[model samples]
Target: MRRFASRGGIDTERGAPMSKTEDESGTNAQERGDGSSQSSVAAGRAFGKAVLRDARRGAALGAGALQRGGRLLWSRLAAKTTKSERRASPARSPAPRGPESGAPASPPFGRRRLRRLMGAALLSLPVIIALSAAMAHILLPNLEEMGARAEDRQVFEDAHGAPLIIRGAVPSAYAPLDTFPRHLVDAVIAIEDRRFFQHGGIDIEAIARALLRNIRSGGIAEGGSTLTQQLVKISYLAPERSLSRKLHEAILTRQLERRDSKEQILEAYLNSVYLGSGATGVPAAARIYFDSAPEDVTLAQSAALAAMIQAPSVVNPLADLEALRARGALVLDAMEAQGRIDADEAGQARDEMAALVPRPPAIRYGTWFSDWITRSAETLAPAPRGVSLLRTTLEPDLQVAAERIIEQHLAAAGSGAQAALVALRPDGAVAAMVGGRDYGESQFNRAVDALRQPGSTFKTIVYLAALAEGFEPGDRILDRQLDIDGYTPVNFDGRYRGEVTMLDAFAASLNAATVNMAMTVGLDRIAQTARTLGIDTELRQTPALALGASEIPLIEMTEAYGAIATGRIPFEAFGIRSASGMAGQDRIALNPVPGASGPQIDRIMAARQDMATLLRRVIDDGTGRRAALTQPAAGKTGTTQESRDALFIGWSGDLITGVWIGNDDNTPMDGVTGGGLPAQIWSEFMIVGLNLADATTVGGAKSLETTPAPAQCNVTACRRAYRSFDVSDCTFQPYSGPRKLCTR
Candidate 1:
């Protein structure tokens, strides 16, 4: 048992040891596994608890930040309230947060709160901008005031109340929106603003497209302004392209859209938009282009007018017919594309346009007269509120004749010379006036504005002064070269007769003799006589004054001669007869009738009769022979130095006319004497004007019965009748009498 026990013991020991080792190893391994499992489970539980705590803290912080942001926003909004509310409310203290409340103190402007405030500011940015824009929009100009200020219309009418010209913002015939033809409206909309009705005031899509186009074209090829915007521009804004102006226009356009309906805005636009050649609206355009009413405009005409909206000056029917037709075709194509008109209608319109032949512009008769009337009306009647009808003294027929005559003479002259003619009644009423050769080429009213030397025509005043100073026409005067006060007077022909009667000296335009007579008659008396006859220009006190050296206007000079014709002193010429308007008619005050019955009137009549005899002698036997008429005519021919100015002023019956031919720059004409072109023009015009043949005179018939017959006397009897005699011809001449006698 011992051996076996030993062996058994060994075996048992080994076995038991092995078993115990195995059991112990298994136990240790099992225990170690169990401990590892427990540790892992504990670690997992700890980690999960830590994560829960962190999540809770984060949620709490987030909630706190949101609450602070809400408080801040509320405070800001509340601070914006009225100060009275702030004063009436109780002030709230910060909440108690020390030991009484189990919460930690929060720092002012913490990171989370800063972030929250930034987010709130970012959220309210668009609202702030929108509010600012609204306030700015409210502070713009008043639309109604602008519209009222832009509603001015001026329609000028001729003497017979025919529409002569239209001017200003709105035309006389302002067609309403309803009066616009359907095709016209469609054409305008298609070409100018396709989405006119769809836009409020500005079209964003259109603007973008225009911007892209402009960028591509490298210029402003398109203006994306809607109809509302265009109306605003026309009615309120100035015509300037600028960023600031565009901004204001955009704002005003929005205001207009808000204030007026689409139709009203369109009506205003159509009535005020400027279509060039002085047409301000569609009505004026229709009347001017087609000579028709706006509603009666044909489809092709409508398209053409609509095309003018883009560039009126360049593409009008008068300026460029082909350009207008091309633009009209584009407008028609656009209309067809917009479905405003079908293919057949578009084709018909195209055919009409292709068949269209532009009418030649009406001959604008009496443009200078019309312009003068317009200017005169400004002061005469002050252009009462709306349309003014100035009944002028302008006889249209006479004006037409005068224009044709002037054109003919100037064309024949062809020296780049200009002429001015002023015709007046014996009573000083301006009948016809041609200011310049072409009113379109130049606007200078030479008749009323040009101050030129009267040359020898001024001798009439000197002779009148001499006559007033008791120098009879038959008085003997030495027609020799004379020098007085360092001034020498020579005859036009540079030849002088030793002795001649005053009538012969006057008829021959003997400068030296007239100057000598002027010296004897006193220069002051001559100036006074000129003023009495209606010369308003300042006269110089010199001997040259006798030789017509005074610079005077043609109108004033003509009026002075009118005094001679009418036997009236201080005669005033007038153009406007009557100015009729919305107010009562104003009969323009004219020069009073020759009612003076004193010695002054008697002296004027005597001087006029004597001067008439001398002037008749000039036409009968002297320099003014070219100015003779079928009936009795009297005039004076005046030629300035170097032929710079040539004039012929005359009267037959109750009509007195003055003609002047000269260069605009005071350049001399090519050997043009007073008796040459000027006298011829005067004679031709007078023949037509006086209607000596089949044509009766404009104002009245010639008074042949009033003309005194020439005196018949022998040499002895004529010498006894006058203080002088023509020894060369053995003729008796009376210079200061109503009639002159020559022994034939």
Candidate 2:
């Protein structure tokens, strides 16, 4: 039997086994007290061990999950580390622990290190996302008022309300989306952006594809811009290639997509895209290329227009027909592939492209005049947006006549010679203008831009100044050779009259006599007189200036002559009569204000009458004798040295016309004088113009009969006999029968 002695009220077992009876008794005793306490202690130890094992497993799993998430975030946020970087790094090994040390083995990633890294990653994610969101928000663009950016039509009309030229955006050329044919829309989409409808503003798949292709090509040869992106760029961003710009474009694109529908976006894009040859939109391109409306355009024409999108100046039909045809074939093939058009349709489109002939150029009557008026209108009344109607003082018939006359006269002059003609009404309104022989040959507006020596035309200014200083038409001056300083001016014919009246010297265009008059009046006063008459060109105060050595624009000289014809100095020559737009009608002051005092007005009137008398003498029997008309006429002939410039400026009735003929290179013409070619052209034009005016009079022949004639004059019979004579200037014929007659 095993015996247990109790010490301090505890039972102790010395031997391994006890008797059956003793075992039974011990078991019962243990079950009652100490056995229960030992069991509870063992259970507590087991539970603590389970909890410890679970905590260790959880920590390992959490570390692995956090590491994976951090790696994914890094891959998304930054460029991936290359394989070369991995190869360059050395391999790490686990450190061996000493037997005496009690620390457990460290994980491949240290627990503390893992905790710090994961904690940082967890904390940075929200900040990074917030920053990205803020940046995207900041880069968003304003999409309000999309139509405001579109160009509006500008229509320029002549005095008769006839459209001289349509400039800027053509109203008829602007077509809405519904007006566009389905084939046109499909063609544009197939060539520009195939996934326009399917993608969000930023097409991720397209971007990836473009990226891969660019990488293989070793250059940025492809762009993944969707239609929305292109619209955003055209509307807001400049055409620049940069990551920052692309980012901004992408952000704006998304905003645009969210704000507008696909149809709206496509419409704006089609209407705003620039095509070649001054066409700005699909409708304009269609009209310019095909001479057809938007909806009437054939599929092949639509394809050609779409092809122009890549490089308008290079691929347009008018610029490069072969390139346009080739590109249009590609567009057709794309449309066929996308199932927008059948293969047979594509073939037909190809045939149409081969047969395509661009519309012949339209006959533009007053291009130079329209361009000048447009520029002036922009400066005077700028239309930010919407249609602008510019009513000008131009007469369509007169413009046509002027153009024809210039072409006819310049043909005989020579191939290298060019001509410019400007005609103004007595009130300083521009009636007709021809900047060059052909505007298509050169866009340089010689009438308003070219500064050439006015020759004797500027003598009018000197004489005008003399008259303002109380010199009369009969005021006599020596017309012999004269030298002032180092400048010596001689007459055009090299023969001078010893002494002559001011009117005779002027009509003969005696340079020496004109210079003497300029000297008497002072060059400064002459310059001031030129300014008062609307000659803005700089005039040298030399003696040569008196003989028209100063260079001046044809328009300015014409305007000065206009002032004399109207008896008004300091008046502006204006082409635009009225300009109305979305902003409002511009209050254009066409006529000069009556600001001159009584005495000043009287002086100007007297000078004007004297100048008129002098000019009439030149036309009647002097240098401009060839320019005389049956009715009262006045003018001056100007021939520069070596005949480099020849001009005839004259007035018949209420029309003031200035004609300039010269070589563009400033070379001399063979025996071409102002009295020869320019005067002939001027006479022919004036004859047609005055006849047309008379024929179109409100009451016809009856209107002429109403004019008050001398008491002995038979107005009707005299007009019938002399169709060209004004009733007031006619006299009764001596042998008058029952049917009274009159003569000039």
Candidate 3:
């Protein structure tokens, strides 16, 4: 024991040396000035001495082994050579030099070779380290902007510049730094980036593990990204799957760690992550999926989001059920392992999440109305992103009623026929729109896009222009076959009812009577009246334009009628009322600009009232009789040649509506007329639009004289006789003498 103690460099005191434990306790070791025992001091000294001794002994033994092995092989070769030489020259003998000459017979290979090999190994270490560091730094990309970009905000609004109520977006109060729950953070980290808290942005241990697994599995089943690295990858880097991109992501992640706190980085990461559908960020995702805030999410919902992160489309609840459940189960297992929930709770959460029903898809109601809304809103702000909320003058109840009426009428008309309806308020504010059967199927809004002839619905403008030309309702006009130059105009039935008053001719839509009136009233004056009523499209200068030869869209026609409804005060129709900047801070109020507002409703009121009186007469007893109602109303019915276009435009004290039914290809409808389906639609819509209001006329409407006057006139008779020279031999005034001779 004493010999062993001395060999170990231990003191041989009164008894045997202290034990290893006692020495470690520092009772037999050195002490510090602060009175704490330096227990590790002896162990450290022992470890260092032992290492040195082992190293020196290993060096000596290695040297001897190499020398001995070399000598043995060299002596054997020399022996074989000498044996061959002896066989050839047996008489020769070689002797060594004498000891007095200070030369040995053999050279030593022991220490010299050891020194050379050691020097070489020592020289190579620094070069290897330098090369490795250079490659690692050069191959990676720089991604310093990822976190900053993730923290930015996005906005959404409608065409009327109104803040849109996005279907699946969480509000601001549910953001990560505020209302987002801490468990969500844990679940994401646990499943996506374990060891996130311990790593310095890039997890080397995880990378090596992932590499080994991939090589063994022969596929990329795992991603070796820290959460910080993922944030850099998603926000700054393109989603290219390559080693070079991964290296760049790692390099940027390290840099990000140096610039931002872990919490700040995490906040940005969660906020920017997409949860699928149309949602772009976490708040948006939360709102879309749960219809709730982030903090309000249950464990099952959290698991659903976590599952979606693996493959958002494949596991989307809105997509596949079985796949989503299987994916969600994987997330639950991860959560359980992370101690976020117990195993039983995790399983229960997964089951519950699988059974949850997804929310409905978004609704895009008021298709045509939304288009007008967009246009009117565009006048205030050029784009939806620039404005906040737009307050519209829409009466929702009235708009709904109008849509319902049109929908019911079309349903009654049955399929294979499409219709578009537009309703406007007295002030020229569009209230409702129904473009087609489905907004999703076709966004091509017909109310504002389809251009068709106004048909006889345009006669009111011609009559009003005649009234303006000092032609009274009782003025003598002829309904005989007429001729103008080489064109002969015939009545709708191809037969003339000779000698009719202006009121009777307009009320019955008599083609010859209107032709004569167009000549007497001047076609230019009629076109001007149409323009003043808000028909902006060009009308032909010829008297043929007096009939409904011009084509107009529903929106333009509605605006024109809207002027007459408001007593001829032409106000430009607008959808948006106001706008604001981001977060509702910077507000810019918009009003109707000039030039869009045209003739005062009062100036044209008398003429419009006169025309309306005649039009109501038409609905009550003339061509538009099919559209006549028990209630007092003013309206016109129009049908194009070959029954191609049918129209009914009318207004009550409450609303003005236009209904058009025809083939989109301009093919004539099967037996359809202005008085048939279109009138039905107009009457139905007005009934609901007026909503039980008593039938009444505009209290101060101008009245046409209630009389029957001169039925035959010289000018009209002579014009018709010359106009029918080609199509008809019958003159305006029948001749008692013979054919082809005018008896005036």
lDDT of 2 by residue, 90-144 (tens): 5652344555466665533334555577888677555544443333333223344
What are the runs in model 3 whose C-alpha is more than 4 Å off?
A: 1-219, 222-312, 331-348, 359-364, 368-408, 438-441, 470-476, 493-495, 498-504, 567-570, 593-606, 618-632, 692-744
Measured on C-alpha atoms, candidate 3 has an lDDT of 0.62
Clashes of 2: 0
Reference-based lDDT, residue 239, model 2? 83
Instruction: Decide which is better by TM-score, 2 or 3.
Output: 2
If the candidates were sorted by their TM-score against the true structure, best first, what order would they fall in?
2, 1, 3
TM-score of each model, in listed order:
0.64, 0.65, 0.59
Error of model 3, residue 573, in angstroms: 3.1
- What's the candidate order when arranged by decreasing lDDT? 2, 1, 3
Residue-wise C-alpha lDDT for candidate 1, range 1-98, written one tens digit per residue: 11112232222211121123434335533356777645644564455445444433443355566677777866765555444456553556456786
10 residues in a row with least lDDT, candidate 1: 1-10
Each prediction's Cα RMSD?
Answer: 31.5, 25.4, 23.0
Worst 10 residues of 3 by lDDT: 699-708
Quantify all predictions' global Cα lDDT against the true fold: 0.71, 0.72, 0.62
Query: Could you tell me how far off, in angstroms, the CA of residue 211 lies in candidate 2 after the best superposition?
Result: 8.9
Per-residue lDDT of candidate 3, residues 691-741 (tens digit): 633212211122212211211223333456475432232233234433332
